[model samples]
Target: MNIAKNMEAIFVAAIVIASATSFATAAVRAPEVITVKAEATEMPTVTITAKRLTAEEKAAL
Candidate 1:
């Protein structure tokens, strides 16, 4: 009975140690960095023109 209890304690201790170690390792390591480059391009220009309405057109509306 004593040996069984000691073995159980050891098993629990091992699991605790493994969990702590994994957490520490994960916290201590830095994450990977990635960089992306986009190509530059010129856009086309647009022109707009407006015309004034005559008195008859305004009356139709």
Candidate 2:
């Protein structure tokens, strides 16, 4: 009788452990990756020159 009771206790403990592990394995989350995105606050722009640099200064650069 004592052996039967001990076996029943172990069986219940194993079933509880297995159920907890199955729940834990099934509740897995996907790996998260960090993504960096810049918000475009404004569009591209262009500017025209009214006065140009000297030829020697441009060539020296």
Candidate 3:
């Protein structure tokens, strides 16, 4: 009876210690943010022109 109570107290103490240890080891780290900028430059663009062949050109083919 008394021994069982002591064993229960020890078990609870062990669980509490284990939990505290884990929490200490798993401490949260501060987050860091980094920013970068580039000198803006004009982006290149391409232009394409297309024309359909006439009926005469198609007949020659």
Instruction: Score candidate 1 by lDDT.
Output: 0.87
Q: Model 3 scores what on Cα lDDT?
A: 0.88
Query: On a 0 to 100 scale, what is the lDDT of residue 61 in model 1?
Result: 97
Q: What is the full ranking by lDDT, best candidate first? A: 2, 3, 1
User: What tens digits encode model 1's per-residue C-alpha lDDT throughout 2-47?
Assistant: 8776998999999999999998898685878999876759667897
**Each candidate: what lDDT?**
0.87, 0.90, 0.88
Tens-place lDDT per residue, model 2, 1-61, is 6877699899999999999999998979878999999899998899887888899989999
Residue pairs in steric clash, candidate 2?
none
The TM-score of candidate 1 is 0.40
Q: RMSD, each candidate, Å? A: 13.0, 15.0, 13.2
Compared with the true structure, model 3 gives a TM-score of 0.38
* Backbone clashes in model 1, listed as residue pairs: none
User: Which candidate do you rate higher for TM-score, 1 or 3?
Assistant: 1
Candidate 2 weakest lDDT stretch, 10 residues: 1-10
* Per-prediction TM-score: 0.40, 0.39, 0.38
